[model samples]
Target: MKWIRKIAGMQSSILGINERNLGFIYPNNARKNYKYADDKYLTKNILHSHQIACPLTYAMIDAIGKIEQAWQATCEWNELVIKPSKGAGGKGIMILKKKNDQWFSQSKPVSEQDIFTHIANIIFGIYSFGDSDVALIEEYIRPHDIFYQIFPEGVPDIRVILLKGVPLMGMLRMPTSRSDGKANLHQGGLGIGIDMKTGRLKEAYDGEKHITCHPDTKHPITGLTLPHWDEIIRMSLKAAMKFPLHYLGVDLVIDQRKGPMVMELNVRPGLGIQLANREGLKDAIYRAKQENLLN
Candidate 1:
């Protein structure tokens, strides 16, 4: 609420999608490098090639026949995340946590048949960009204690915007009960803006309301500092450099044991990130270009 009053006085620096496309996306991103960032499987392979840490892939199912094999291989693990390799906005991601020998998705018990149907839809491009996609079953990361304190139900991830290997802005996304335990802002999750310099919480927004505390957890979201702040930025920048793109959005998650690992890379990252930071991205973009950082 306090930030809302301050927002009026502050000159808006929001970067519109048109400007983003003309100024950053089209000029910076290349068609050749899109595959590495757009496809989750390829992203993992590329990250592994560069020795960058990411969620471990247990198995990949490209067809219906492979689904049974992949599921059997993953059965040994108590928890696993199965998702469309080319999915966007958290669509078709099933997180299975085993309890008392039963698998559950979002705490609801799911049968092997249900999972198979989901994977079938993924292979049919139901969750992808109208193209056939593979299903990637990966190790589910358990976030650190700090994230648990903020929101105990779902995984929280940080999105850092980078320009030519420099981190310009960042935000932390926490899932709410309404989001069905998915850390996506469009799906009722909380977006807390992070100060890029210190990785400290600067502001919080939930799509509709701007607040200081989480609506569900009632935990204060401001002034909280992310663990391994510097490492997060470093890892984001490192991942960005691996791509040929001049601008990128690197999503990083903090594993309880691993510290920081890249979850995904976005060549055309959403502009909603500016809303979380309470700052305009246009200024940062102009600055980067003027400094020749875009080169």
Candidate 2:
């Protein structure tokens, strides 16, 4: 079956932020329920309790005094991902790998002091929207082998926007040299469209123009279908049902071994996905409404 009901011959209606906030976010999701999607640690708690697929959290620090304790607990791992609990837009996220007794981030050596400083900044709300935030130290996720063809390294994430627990639209965000290995469109990465029914990738959009292949690797990326498409959908639906929020933007990554792991959720997912898919959220919502599928 098609992921969305067909609306033939009609033009796709672009969804703007104002409309998104008013139409879907405000009506479907209440302000008090935002924490289900806003806080990374809280989101993971739901995932963990439900036994859903996600990266294992090594440690979390919410106070300056707990910094050393949290770091010491998770520092034994050769690799770790540090991020703000309430961060948005991929901010305050760092990956540290141990190489020959030295910790490194993005292939550059970082001192033990550097790791501690980053975590302190996270707790102080440096990368968060609030004045203070929790720091999450999680096991680093290794991207699926299929992504190596798209980029030499870096994990690309799949963003699935859902309404009323049903999948609406999807996009594959991949990293590039300019994005510093971060797969966010606004950070100079590429947003590749996804075929909802086929799970195959469409063209790549670099926040400006659409292309068919990776700009740096020159590898043909379009038409390659991602594995475990059905499981990915079910995994998303499980998380959505666990939360009180009706509107969600669920971010996930395909781990080389774990298949699909939920990364985080957003009550207010961006509208740039429209450009990535060359389709519109307005159009998808309208179609879902007509089919009585959003119930």
| Number of the top TM-score candidate | 2
Q: Write the per-residue lDDT of candidate 2 for residues 122-202, one digit (tens) a residue.
A: 999999865799999998898988897789666799989999987999999999999999997778889898988789999
Give Cα-based local distance difference scores for all models: 0.87, 0.86
Per-residue error at 106 for model 2, in Å?
A: 0.8
Candidate 1: pairs in clash: 13-280
Q: Residue 135 in candidate 2 has what lDDT?
A: 91
**Reference-based TM-score of each model:** 0.93, 0.94
> What RMSD, rounded to one decimal, does every model reach?
3.2, 4.6
Instruction: Tell me which residue pairs clash in candidate 2.
Output: none
Model 2 ranges off by over 4 Å: 1-12
Model 1: lDDT to the true structure: 0.87
Error of 1 at 170 (Å): 0.4
Model 1, span 1-295: residue lDDT tens: 3333444455657776677788778888888888888999989988999999999999999998888988888889999999999999999999999998999998899998998999999999999977999999999999999989878888999999987677788999999999988898878888889987788897788876678987888998899999999999889988998878778899999999888999999888876677788778877767767878765
